[model samples]
Target: MIRIRLGARGLGGVRFAVSPMGSAKDLLRLVGFNPGTLTPSWRSRATDALTRHRLGLLAVVGGGGPLGYAPDFLRPEPPAFLTDIDTALHQIATTPQERIRYELAEAVNGHSWDPGSGHPAPRQLLQALGRGEDHFARRLADEMARFWHAALKPSWPAIRTRLEADVTARASDITQYGLAEALNRLAPNLEWRDGELLVHLRTDSIHRLTLDAEAVILTPSVFVDRALFCAGEPPGTPAPRTPLIVYPAAKVDCLPPAQDPLIGATRRKLLAELSQPRSTTEIAKRLYLSPATVSYHLQILHRAGLVTRARRSRHVLYQRLGGMV
Candidate 1:
């Protein structure tokens, strides 16, 4: 559990940010390589696209075993409305070379994976950065570009809309219920009491942070559901800790869409099966229906917005929408 002590000025500095870069990293986890802590609703068609294109960086980015660490350079503060991928890449490319060297050195030296064991692709990439080669920096940016183009860009509109809705809802909560109430509503295991914000984590470790005047960026993420992820300053950094808390947004309009009169019994069963996201293959096997038939019905449901579809890891999955019983 971690507790943050907020000073008089802390609440004033608290703000919400939408990070495109952060979303990209979260999306990477949803890909087939390493799902980390995400419970993806559907199989990852995005990952399949990445694999089919032979984007080898997927291994490096997600490759340090299950609890692997993506480089800190990928974690940038949110830029406003970040519509251009080139702009985000430019920010990464222009990171102070000294900071890059410092962060990469730390990652290689104290990575969770065994330092003396077999080197993974993430380690290899870190080693490249440690060698004072700026090419790998660009290489990282290029990989983000490819992943964004192939996987994220197509569904960005819907994702952005969901994020916007969450923001609006939270904003309303703050206005009506106050900051602490709004914060508590974000997750079940969080609370604000007597100037401290408490977070219940899964680990036995405890942390107490006091934000005097530094701003706390509370970010809403679609992929992170169960708990909160806090990104803080690395050891030996020259700057003050700028903490970013990424938490799963409260789903609002996930109710099942209106029913159609023409829908048949088999399709209804498929809809019920999609209470959570399920891939066509999984649904077919469960219902003893042919994959083709399931796919056809899913397409119809998706067209009506009665079901929502997303790609997770290597499978395309679907779920009922609009609060269906």
Candidate 2:
């Protein structure tokens, strides 16, 4: 369990921003490491591009499994609401050598080195980073740029739209309902209780963070299927910066037209109705459509890898995949 205690000042300082590099890293994770809930067609295209570009360094740096540890320096908190890829890459390329050393050491300490773990020669990479090598960081940045263009750039507009919608919805929730309600709606694993935001992680270890004055930046990502917490300052940072919470955005109405031509207006409406699990009859009643029509569209969407269905007692429930968009 990871509990973040946000005082009044910390709560007031909470804001939302979008990070391109963060999404890029998540893209890498979806392609090179964990597929999570990504659609088959999209994942296939991204895989082909990754193979064509031969992003060796990126594969090593970003190849950690879904729950594996990666260096935090790879995705720095964006300074603005919408940070372009160039600016985010620059921030990574110019990371101080001391911070790089510290982060690399932290990674090394957390996991044992495995030569065949899809991470090619991580020890050598760490050694290069430890020597205050400028070229190492530059090469990393260059790889990230190439990877972004190859895998994520094509779908960036749709991705950005989804992230923006999530931010807007959450912001409105904060205004209309309250911060606590907004926080609880972020993910199923997160909860707001007693002035603390509790993140129920897969790990058994417990960590408590007090946000003294540092704010929490809520950044939504299309590739992140779950909530992720990023905090703490690397060694040589000027001061403690805002923490980041990268959660999955709602997965409706963000698909590029080229990606799925089958998603017509009716299917789109059906998808929106599936923000939560529902039965065919329930969806039909809500959308004012016949159960047969809803079932037909749901079957098409299920075949396209956009939704999943499972039996729940006497009824079957369908829900949209988290990373479909």
Candidate 3:
């Protein structure tokens, strides 16, 4: 369950400090108990704050990003928060004791896609061990590696990627508690105040943090804009890119080599014919490529949720899904 100390009388009566860079709605949701009652501006303001953020440490909400590999997604049925954790641990302990394991996982399909009916709770899942008859030690280390870095998983592809993906997914209207959701989802052990989950370097509360925060995010549904505990002064006046932005670019860059030349050309031909509904063969011929190549890229795009297909006249028609803007 969400944790936050509340006051009597009203949400305003609740006395606490808030982090600076979180969704105002997350705070409002915690204090006001109204996720849907928030105004559209609340969502818009939250998005603006994220985009304006210099350090890019904010979390993603409302569906955005590569969708590369969300380990959390495993099945369609989700369990209760506590139940999910319990089951996850149980699976790790009892599932034939494989060396490698998936620490964070989620269900694959949703029973329905109702508003507020998107993601199931954390429980309601089956855990299966990895298959490998040999190399127990190697696999064990790999499994532990994921667990050790589990906290970072939710913030993957850099915080920017997560934020971007979230924005893209929910471009129209939204009720997202960005900052709180990010902290809680990324690292749930911390307490909540003003709707932002405390994710300080120090495990202690904001008061105990020896150093200042690198960043703070406010959520939607707010104007008085509480939650302003910055780590320290920003050297001078603030700009878009706050604090500093130095990195071991060459040391940690993990992007794969640019797309293969042949694959790249094939991709272009597929896109050109996606205007109206057409089968892979139709597009392939227009681009002078084989149906097999078109089908492969189509698979990738579909998995990316970019292209949609339907069976029309007993033949599948692929249409370019146009949500990414």
Q: Which RMSD values do the candidates have, in order?
A: 6.9, 8.2, 19.6
lDDT of each: 0.63, 0.72, 0.32
For each candidate, how many residue pairs have backbone atoms clashing (under 3 Å)?
15, 0, 33
Candidate 3 lDDT, 13-118, residue by residue in tens:
2211121112221322222223234334333433344444421211221121122112211110112211223343333233232212221221123211112454
Q: On a 0 to 100 scale, what is the lDDT of residue 122 in model 1?
A: 59
lDDT of 2 by residue, 143-244 (tens): 888888887786676566557756876777788788899899888888889988777776653444444434778888877767877755433454345677
Give the per-residue lDDT digits (tens) of candidate 1, residues 1-325.
6666678777777888776667777666555334544343323545565687666654455333433445556656665534356777776666666656665554465442446667533545656565564776676777777777776676566566556656777887888899989988877777788887777775643444444334577877776664554545534564324666777765534312222353567777886787787999999999998999999988977765456787889999787642211
Between prediction 2 and prediction 3, which has the larger TM-score? 2
Stretches of candidate 2 off by over 4 Å are: 65-67, 111-124, 130-133, 204-213, 233-240, 253-325
Candidate 1 deviant stretches above 4 angstroms? 30-43, 62-65, 81-84, 116-123, 130-133, 204-213, 234-236, 239-241, 254-325
Ranking by TM-score: 2, 1, 3
Better lDDT candidate (1, 3): 1
Give me the runs in candidate 3 sitting further than 4 Å from their true place: 1-263, 323-325
TM-score, prediction 3: 0.24
The positional error of residue 285 in candidate 1, measured at the CA in angstroms, is 22
